[model samples]
Target: MAATGTYTETFVELIRRASAELPAEVAEALRTGREAEQRGGLASIALNTILENVDLAREASAPICQDTGTPVVWVHHPTGVSTRAVKADFEAAVREATARTYLRPNAVNTLTGANTGDGSGRGIPFMHFEEWDEPRIEVRMILKGGGSENVGAQYKLPDGKLGAGRDLDGVRRAVLDAVVQAQGKGCAPGVLGVCIGGDRVSAFEASKRQLLRPLADTNPMPELAALEERILREGNELGIGPMGFGGSTTLLGVKIGVLDRLPACYFVTISYMCWAARKAGVSIGEGGELTWLS
Candidate 1:
């Protein structure tokens, strides 16, 4: 379970790429959303500024957003690999990335009210490890900002207030309600990752996991796919256009995931991601070769 210098450096590069560059599919979605907005409208202007910022960040090899957000990492590795070693290397890389200015020092001490200057705290860079049959190590990361994270919502089904039941319709209602509540606050023109069924904690985890999917991917389940489309269509129709400016481009994409729930609990969770939506992945071969995956 020893960390190698090469692995640590490669992880640093991975963090750099994820922090500085927006994924192509997400950028394309933003472009398409911009084009759909009225020419001289606020939505168009906001998207235009966003696109320019994306380009500037890439060109300068800098963090995409001022609040670099929390680095949430998922590691998939071969059975023989050591998860503890991987986590140690990842933590090292996160600190180095922070020092290099690719990430801001956002981690703070709750009781002391002090900033963890190196982005290392109790659970600053959250990591999850999974062992697979693959011979190589695959690391994927997403930088989730506090603003969007604050807007994430979880709802229990059979709620009388929203009239949501333990069904797909209920899920839809909950999602729309989240969007309405988050109008322009989660840095609008955002993406929604939803989980239909699970316990409270697992449902939120599954919802955030859905955000790792590509923006252009279609859900394997037909019903979920249709619901995704419906939410996207109806969300934009609310006139909560880019930054809630009243335009055609409210949401760029919607991803849904489902999990088994207990008989008594039907929880629906929604994770909202801002336009930045920064994520990246890398696969490290046994020979130390690296392959970039977006």
Candidate 2:
């Protein structure tokens, strides 16, 4: 089946919006963090600079961060639509976005260490597609920066070093340790997306995908929800503050996902995102109307 120009245009618009604008929820979290800091302090100053940068980027339609990071797309579509066609449309959009500077040339060759000037290289703009019963198509994109990406961590259950066993308490230990280890390197105050159980690769993928969730939304699982809250509170208590300058606020939010794993393996994965937190989604109807979601 042939993809329409409108579809391609919609993809381009999604890229532009996701690249250029910080999502509303993330922006609100930043504002709240700024207000929570002590007046005229280093943390407060850092937050002010961050908020200013956010406003300028949005107003000018420029990338919110120097490192545009990686484009990870999740597409949920009706069964009849072609996944291949959807991918092709998105790849074309990425090329156009790069030419237009919505994205920098971020695709790097793993072995040769060469940059893919067009932002389309082997495995770049990584995509995940799912078939759904819903008639409309929903596309969600997260631009995860390299700085925060560097701080992502994974832990095995029953870790002797931390005295963490294969349980909820253990999971909490691992998550908090990750935050302490990251310090200001990942660009605090940051948001964390975590997965409780899964194999190595799937665990990391689920952790990153959890970042798509809104900062204000609580997890349906009461246990997980409470853990998220506790993590956020304790992370801030670390005094890593904004950009690690030291202050009251260190974390903006925490989101967790759980997946069942094998009997012998228990894994916890942490995905860190800087305050920029560039994420946005759109729903495209069959008639070509677009609805924005965050």
Quick one: best TM-score, which candidate?
1
User: What is the per-residue lDDT of model 2 for residues 36-102, given as tens digits with 9 covering 90 to 100?
Assistant: 8899999999888988888898898888887888889999999798888888888888888888898
Q: Which stretches of candidate 1 lie above 4 Å from their native place? A: 1-4
For candidate 1, report its TM-score.
0.97
Off by over 4 Å in 2: 1-6
Candidate 1 minimal-lDDT segment of 10 residues? 1-10
Report lDDT (CA) for all predictions: 0.89, 0.89
Per-residue error (Å), model 1, residue 184: 0.7
TM-score of each: 0.97, 0.97
Model 2 per-residue lDDT at 118: 90
- Per-residue accuracy of model 1 over 1-294 as CA lDDT, tens digit each: 555556788888888898899998888999999888889888899999999999999999999998888888889998888788888888888889899999998899999999989987898789888888989999988999999999999998888999998889888999999999999888888999999888887887788788899998899999999999999999989889888888878788999999998899888899999989988999999887899998
Whole-model lDDT, model 2: 0.89
- The clash count for each model shown is 0, 0
